[model samples]
Target: QLRETLGIELPTNDAPPTSLETATPTQPVVPQSDHQCQSNQDQSPEPLDTSERQNSDLRAQSTEPLHTSEPQNSDLRAQSSEIIPVSSKEFMSVSSLIRGRVKLEDVNKTYQMIWTRFKEEGKTDPLTPGDMYKMGLKVTGQTGEAKLKVLRALKIVHISNKGAVKLL
Candidate 1:
């Protein structure tokens, strides 16, 4: 009698669902009221506390703003403001960075010409980092010894354990 009043029979853990409950397994059981429903279909699912917590957690985790459907920018121009964007073409390799100041091929050729002359003088050992640093300064006129990086990239010179460079 009590189950009839509530429109559902609570099943025991061991018992299978009754035919009355199993008739519409796919559908939600909504209690019929004396008033008419605005629509036949159910919209907006039952709100969950976990969903709200998840949304809050997502907002806390993100450092950047969320994306929207509409074009937010007014000018419709490419945004050049942010450097090192998500695009691959915008990034530069170390070799490429070296090339921006001095061409590696030219530097490598020049060093090889110099090295051949030195080799003829019986200097067979690899040049030290200091030697490369000196060479970098002499050839590229860069005080930071960054030209060695170009040489390293070109595989024409290498540094020794004692901090000197040797020609490979």
Candidate 2:
């Protein structure tokens, strides 16, 4: 039961979805220029797939009130009406760091944050999976490696066999 609540490690057996990079042509490496960012920002991102649609749909269905900050699993916090299993509940709580049920969107925002941070650091190279996962912790505010796993599950980011982290 404790292992379930503390789903700190994402099992590698449950593979992530096919990233947009593989789904479409390889995304050009993000250039290190403000102009490049501005131009790209002007263009909208691609449409969501069936899995993404289902994920967003589930988010919208949550009747729970939005928390200014996500609720921590400790004493002093009020519990919600939905009582899921401990393991499932803990993982979903990671998504709760986001404003609404739409966690995939939050993953996108987190990707942009990572991209911008890398550019600001004057690096054009993709971050290593460890570095990117560390960045995920700050951007998503999900403890342990839950944020990394969530991002993987949503197909917003991918960590390769060589440990390179790519935004998708």
Candidate 3:
């Protein structure tokens, strides 16, 4: 039991998504000015896929209540009615961090925190496959094309991927 609880190492794999750069066609006429032409950078995150929907829903549900910044040691800590597993709890923390609910300068900081937690628990890696997408969707809601644009802004989704839909 002790081995199962404390000795087992959790495996996590970190795969950074490939970023696509879009090129805008140059206009035949150049405006005479002191300013130089600049290429637009895509700032949106990745769009949610079928493979990520359920996990995204689950992550969003779990994180909905934990956004409060109440002190951990306070007696008024909120109690959840659901019985959550350790893995699920960890998922929430990591997902929340990814979604920027922790309010860090960058998502990488949250990634480091998640990595450190898993490492401390004798695990080399931590994030589950779908958890990454869930975190992405939470960071950018499925509200609409504009919402997807927000996802693209974060560079979280692959735009040319088959699962991505064309938005107006």
Candidate 4:
């Protein structure tokens, strides 16, 4: 009579969920209101408090701005900015027999530097040892003259080996 009057069922931990009148196997009711949400939010705080403290410490330690152009500019450009860009077809056209242990990256860098200089200097002639030597010398930590000298020596070696060569 009391259960019929109140119209509420007591919760039993031992009862299977399937036996509950208010809960179906597929859907269980959840009661969430604005106050409940706010209470839950107040109970659990954000984890960023430690990070904020560290940031304050970092700010106190230095007067310089975190994002300074001076610091950003510290990074340097690549060494091979003076070489001309040469296609595989162009390279092969020069000589298939000119094979070396030279790296493709190094060759590409050299080509880029040459192309840049040629474009800027308004020179259209084939890439010269002097030209590459100048750029390579700067990047390879050798003198321009020395670079030219080494290239000349390599040329002699290539010719002696009977390799078809195109000099650019």
Best by TM-score: 1
Q: What would the TM-scores of all predictions be? A: 0.31, 0.27, 0.17, 0.25
Off by over 4 Å in 1: 1-94, 104-106, 128-144, 161-163
Quote the lDDT for 100 in model 2. Answer: 39
Model 1 vs. true fold: TM: 0.31
lDDT of 3 by residue, 1-168 (tens): 665989887766566542222223552444556345544453456798987988989988966765557543112211432222122233334433334433332333333333343434444433442443554423233322232333233432223343342211
**lDDT at position 63, candidate 3:** 64
Per-residue lDDT value at 131 in model 1: 57
Q: Please, what are the lDDT tens digits per residue for candidate 1 over residues 102-135?
A: 5444454555544653454557766654454455
Task: Give Cα-based local distance difference scores for all models.
Answer: 0.51, 0.52, 0.38, 0.43
Off by over 4 Å in 3: 1-104, 129-168
C-alpha lDDT of candidate 2 relative to the true structure: 0.52
Q: Is candidate 2 or candidate 3 better by TM-score?
A: 2
Error of 3 at 75 (Å): 42
lDDT of 2 by residue, 84-142 (tens): 12234444655454323444444445545654665445465766656756765343334
**RMSD (Å) per prediction:** 19.1, 29.9, 30.2, 18.4
Question: Highest lDDT, which number?
Answer: 2
- Against the true structure, candidate 2 reaches a TM-score of 0.27
